[model samples]
Target: MTSTPISKISSGVSRRNFLRTGAIGGFLLATGSATAMLTGCAKSVPASDRLFLREQDVVVLTALIPIVLADALPTGEARAAAVTRTLAAIDGFVGNTSPAVMDQLYQLFDLLSLPPARVAAAGLWSDWPNASEKDLLAFLTRWQHSSVGLFRAGYAGLVKIITAGWYLLPESWPAIGYVAPVRVV
Candidate 1:
């Protein structure tokens, strides 16, 4: 079997190598900034319904919610309600965070929401709405075990945020054996 040349391997940027360089964020920021400028995303102000996450960001998070919360997420009819509640929770969590942290989350959301960044950074070729659950899971798994620290951190942050949203729902407590504490006057 023929092998790839060292020069070629070094010159060509694969997702792994690209992630290893720790420049994916910078690349995404630059591209996202340009896209934002052209598309008016830079001036996107959140509506009263949502504090920070925009509609596109909500779409991205909606796709992520089920996958990340899988078992903890209720099935059947309850699933929709749980997802809505979780979205609200996530919105509150992101909205109430420190400005710096909130800004970082916006950057992450922008990276995921942009088509080019989604494909290049996360290997998601389809838009968040059209992406298969399996594909999304693979992306999450890859980032979870990635050699790059940034990806690992991103994965951790995502999982933490998603789960926090899920657990914050009172209905989800039964699954995790958490009972709401009664307050005594």
Candidate 2:
């Protein structure tokens, strides 16, 4: 019987190590591809046109508002109008905020705009238009209920902004049963 030397018997790298390396490489490749695809898919927003929120930012918010508001959001054309008005309100509010706050919002929006980041952070893989109400609600619930502080903060921040912006619209007041204060001459 011939005995094979230990060095020659097996390769230096174990199967586990090989798999680990492959997995890391695969992840990097996938991430890069997703980034490229997302970048290509992004609509170019003119710098001058953006006051506080970019087009992508609006997309994220519009997709999320209905889910965040759920039953509170009206149906059909009213919902469409509400989304538009609320987005405008959010834009105005964002513009008025301090530069630091605005920067944070921009960062968050940019992060969400990336496909991989959106999937990892928001648990959303498809475009907002393609996402179902159930999926959106699930994502929100996960973030809200997550053990991580960052996820909790993300949930709180999004909910606060969407709800606040929506309620700020005069049309939304009646829905929420908030009567406007009487004005004295």
Candidate 3:
């Protein structure tokens, strides 16, 4: 697995400090829940529709999948198919997590769903559907290098989720020269 380098900040806002202040919870309450209510996305979706990720989360991942996968991602019509499959894998991964972890993931997704928060936190002014590759890259780069520990944590979580989701798929194994172990009789 490839590791992302994070630079330390000289500021007083450490990860512990960020969590202790409940800023993320505040963001979720103020923006995420409000946006969800306004957009009617707070309603529970049917079981068959989605496991964990909401429709808005899908939009965010759809934009991010290609950029994160890069050369490993297939091109042409297959590109869309690959992304779809990877999303399913991601859903499965998220679905199996504990409820607390799931809630945290949802908070992150919801935060990104808000336009104002998306712009301020990710530097993504446009919706995920309309964001260019350059814009996406810049956002990822900024988060990776951000002085704020929370931003760095989010960056790490996102990259780990995306990469893990993609690599967990059997179809993606061949690309990285991974072959499942043979069973012993």
The residue ranges of model 1 lying beyond 4 angstroms of the native Cα positions read 1-20
Please say which candidate is ahead in lDDT: 1 or 2: 1
lDDT by residue (tens digit), candidate 2, 52-152: 77777888888899888877878988888888888888888878889788765655666566777778667788987788988888988988886545567
Judged by lDDT, which candidate is best?
Answer: 1
The TM-scores of all predictions, comma-separated, are 0.83, 0.72, 0.79
RMSD of each predicted structure: 6.0, 10.9, 7.2
Error of 3 at 165 (Å): 1.0
Model 1 per-residue lDDT tens digits across residues 8-75: 58646566676555675566578877876677656556656998778877898899999998987778
Candidate 2 error regions (>4 Å): 1-50
lDDT accuracy of residue 42 in candidate 3: 60
Regions of candidate 3 where Cα sits further than 4 Å from its true position? 1-30, 33-47, 183-185
Prediction 3 TM-score vs. true = 0.79
